[model samples]
Target chain A: MKIEGVVFKAGEVPKTLFKIVSGTVRETRNKTYHDLGHGDYVALLEYLLEEPIQENIVATEETEIIEVSLEDEYLNIIKRIIELRKVIFESSIDLEDIVLDDFNFEKVDIDKYLEQVESLLTLSAGDLPDDRDEALRVIESLDDDKIITKVNLVRSFIEKFPEEEEGARLLIETAAKVYIVLNDRYVAKSLLKKLLLHYSDIPKFCYEAIKTLEGIYRDEGNIIWRRYNKIAKILEVKLRGND
Target chain B: METIEFEPGQEIIKEGEEAQYIYMLKSGKIKVQLGLYEFVISDNNPEVFGLEALVGEKYTETCTTVENSKLICCNSSEFMEIYGKTEVSKKALESFMRRTAKVLGWI
Candidate 1:
């Protein structure tokens, strides 16, 4: 059927999905525009979840769409995953904008920034935020205790950088040290492993990772200790040759 | 093709270094480090690394071996003399295009 404007209002459950046979529709949520063109699915995620539609799907131009029912469970799952990824990825982009905006030399409210970092922790996979330089600046300016208090969030923040910059390395190393004190040795071990992966060429960080990782493994059972022991020994030999 | 072997954790190429050879993975795993992104090239892959040498550009990324590995190495003139007319040149160009597309998020 031909449609024009406000096809699906926000908060209204659009029980049916539409295949855009022609023209375009704009999906807006929280002031962001997600334009959909030919062959795009409208309200598919909302329909699949049977939840209130969170976005206003409006026909930006007089558009043609066919109401379609999704019956294949496998395809529905794939669609759900795609929609979820879009949500998470877009959230990262939005957070990057907010970080860039608030990141400045002026004194920052630590609690406000901590809330932002907590949200960033939820993003497991996506492009590194373009505002990472400012983000790192903000992270670096924080007190060690503040970072350690939220070490898991700090680790996730640093891991977003592909290469370990000086600031990032320092932050992750600090996180590794204090996470164990908080009884979160798992985060410590993972950060230590990340240090090894990115800084293998640098003996200083390599030795630190090997030392900390060994200490963490030592607290485990004999089998786990022995398993980590072999790798640590190999890295130690490599570090010695570089010295 | 002249073959060179790199031990695991060895730095085969450094970013900003002069591009010397087009490298083809012969065996084992190699990591290509670009900015904040990394991808692996393994044995039996038809792609080549260090294409910057062909254009006389500096190596854009550092390449390192993740395991003891062998690579087919060819300098610019050598590459032209060897894979110049063969299907390998086309494949190499295609690989470069695919990687460029990925970096641009076009695919």
Candidate 2:
């Protein structure tokens, strides 16, 4: 493909998938431009979902692409990888430093860094009661910047301490609160809902989870108010002490 | 809050349709069709579908009855409120949805 040549125009039904072999392609979605070079591709999510291929793909330079088929054999492999992430996520088993992007698994230093993360989970909140900010600073600020690192660390903590309810609760609460600023709302919600039930017996845990839920509801226009109300009622009755 | 019965081949949901409920299969089997790309056998008790409704998105695939079946369906929010109450139930339901998302295409 040569410069300005359209590969896949926006709003077209994807009949075939394409992968870049060399040179560059420009992808414009919703007016945002992304440059794709060798080994770069476009619209896999839209294609896999069978939704309209709503992005314009044009060559930025002399480019070459091989048509990729969405055949069963190909789809099954994609399916297996998605299933693997879900299972790995649920287990909190660090796939070294794996994070999902472009269907690529980014492995990290598992044996060493994960051990540091695991030890961080065991730190006592009571040990730093006076310096909440200082203590949390030790666990990564969870600032909007570097949020991915925070999410992975929190996920590892949740996975590592399923049997240790306190450690898990702390990580879950962090996800619902700190991660709300990041792009992991749904993933955070999953952990929040799970922890809300798993540690509902502890008044403190219930309080934290409810606060997070309330914040999310507020941010999302409170459309799920009834659901929030119902959860609040159940937690209220189950709450042991200190409202 | 309602139990709907599906005579075999009845469509409970269609691909790209706006999602209204999250369904937990009460009995019998259902075929989850992913735009002719895949078909899933969801026969397990409490086999849940339309879970992407939780993300407030449209249906990702079609769900039709494969055998005479019953489904206990709840609005997305209501389903979350109820399922968010127990460890085992919440975990099992999440697991089921995660598996289904892979095979169900749009989810």
The DockQ leader among the candidates is 2
Interface RMSD of each: 16.1, 14.0
Model 2 chain B, TM?
0.76
Question: How far off is residue B58 in model 1, in Å?
Answer: 0.4
What docking grade does candidate 2 earn?
Answer: incorrect
TM-score for each of the candidates: 0.33, 0.29
For candidate 2, the TM-score is: 0.29
> What is the lDDT, from 0 to 100, of the residue B6 in candidate 2?
83
For model 1 chain A, where is the 10-residue window of minimal lDDT? A96-105
User: What 10-residue stretch in candidate 2 chain A is worst by lDDT?
Assistant: A97-106
| Window of ten residues with lowest summed lDDT in model 1 chain B | B98-107
lDDT of 2 by residue, B1-107 (tens): 68888899898987567778888788888877652234555556456777556555566567888899888888866775677445423443344444444432224
Clash-forming residue pairs, model 2:
A97-A108
